[model samples]
Target: MRQALLLALAALVIVSCGRRGPQPQAVEPQAFADTTPPSIIYPAFGDADPHPWEDRHPGHYPVHGLDVSRWQPPIDWRTARASGVSFAFIKATEGGDFADPKFDEHRRGAQAAGVPWGAYHYYYFCRPAHEQARWFIQNVPKGADLPHVLDMEWTPHSKTCRIRPDGRTVRAEAQKFLDILERHYGRRPIVYTTVDFYGDTDIGRLPKTEFWLRSVAGHPRNVYPRAIWRFWQYTGTGLVPGVQGKVDINTFNGTPEAWAHWKAGG
Candidate 1:
C-alpha cells in the first residue's frame, strides 16, 4: 500500500512538472506594432533630368506607372492612363507555393486597356532556385508585354521568410534563378532590389542582367552601391489619380528607340 501511494505521488508530481513545459522561458511577450509610416526619401523628381523624362504636358512625365498587389483593388486604368500611366508591373507569384491573386485581373485589365504591362515574382532566398523560377514561369504567361522582374529584397516582416541565406549564397541562388528565367522567358529578367540588399549581395557581378533599382532618395548611382541601373523605383506612396491609396512609381532608363531595339534584340 505504501509503495503504491509513493508511486502515485511521484506520477502526480511528474504530470504537474510536464504540464509547465520549460516555463515558456519567461519570454516577456514581445511588444506589438501598430500602423507605421514607411520611410520617405526624395519626395519628388524635381532634381532629376526633366529633359530626358517626357512630361505628360510639359512638366510631367508621360510614362509614370504603378506596381500593385492584390491589396490594391479596383484599378481605374482609364483614369490612370489619363493621369500619365503608360505601364504596370503586377505581382504574380513567390517562392514555389504562393501566388498573387491580382495577377490575372491586372493582366486582363491592362490588356483590355491597351497598356503595356509586366509581371514580378517575389523571391524567397531560402527556396531552391529552380523551384522559384518554375513558380514564376508556371504562373505568368508567355509573350508578356513587359519584362519579368525578380523582386529581391529583405522582407523583414515576411511571414514565411523572416530569415534568409548569407550574401554569397543569396547571390548564387539569384544567379541560378535568373539563368532559369532567362532560358524560359527568352530575355534576361530584371533584378529589382533595394540599395541595402544590393550592397549586401555583390549584385554588380550580375552585369548581364538589367536592374530595376529601388532608391527613393537619390539617383541609383548615389544610392545603389553598384554603378548602373536600367529602371528606377522612386516612390512607393505616390498618390496617383486612379490609385485610391499609395502606389509604386517607376522610370525607364533609355530612349524609345533604345527600348524598341532592346525588345527586338530579345
Candidate 2:
C-alpha cells in the first residue's frame, strides 16, 4: 500500500510539472487604420509644395508643427506623424463659456497618434479674465503633456467684443488669467499674440512669460523687434500632409535638443 501511494504522489508531481500555467492572452493589434473622411487625403497636395514656408525660407528651423480647431477636417494623425509633424496645439475653449466643438476629438486623435499636444484658450476682450480663466479650467482637464497657452489677440473688429481695453487693464487681465492657469497647470503658461496686440498691450514687457508671436509677413525678429519669443506662427495659409485646406504652421525658437527639454516639462 505504501509503495502504491508513493508512485501516485510521484505521478501527480510529474503531471503538475508538465502542465503549463495560463498562457498570456494574445494582444489585439493596435488600430491605426485610417478612418478619416475620404475628402482628407494622406498628402493633401500631390507634386505640390506642401510646406511653402520652408521653400520660401531656405535653411529655416527643422522642427515644424500645426495648430488646429473645428475649422479643419478630420485628420489622419498617423500620416501627419509620419510626415514630420512634431507637436500640435489644439484649440480648447473661447471666451468664458464657449468651447471649441472639435477640441475633444483633436485632443484624443493627437494623443493616440503619439503626438505631444497642448491646449489654448482664445481670450475675449468683453469677458472678464477671471471668468474666462475659470471657464477654461473647468473645460480643459489638468495633467496635459504640454503647457497651456493664452491666445491674446486684438478684438477691435470682433462682432462680439470690440472693446480694446487700455494697456494697464489688458496687462492686469492677462496677469489674472496667467495666474489662474499657472496655479492650475503647475507650469508657466505661454502667451500668444499678434503684432498689433503685442504692441497695443505691451505684452513683451510682461514679467516672466514666454511668447508665441504671429509673424506671417517676415521673421519674428523683424516683426516683433526687441521681444524674445518661444514659438513663431509663420503662416496661416500653410499646406501640410494629413490636413485639409490651409492650416497655421509654426516653429520653435531653439534647437531640437531644447525642444526635447521643453516637451519633457523641464
Among all windows of 10 consecutive residues in model 1, the one with the lowest summed lDDT is 27-36
Q: Give the alpha carbon lDDT tens digit for every residue of 108-201 in model 1.
A: 8887887788899998876788999988898998878777889998889887776656788887888988899888878878888888788877
Range of the 10 consecutive residues with the lowest summed lDDT in candidate 2: 27-36
> What ranges in model 1 sit over 4 Å off?
1-62, 263-266
Residue 158 displacement (Å), model 2: 2.2
How well does candidate 1 score on lDDT at residue 61?
Answer: 22
Root-mean-square deviation of each candidate, in angstroms?
A: 17.5, 20.8
lDDT of 2 at 219: 64
Per-residue lDDT tens digits for candidate 2, residues 100-147, read 999999999989998888899999888899999999998889867888
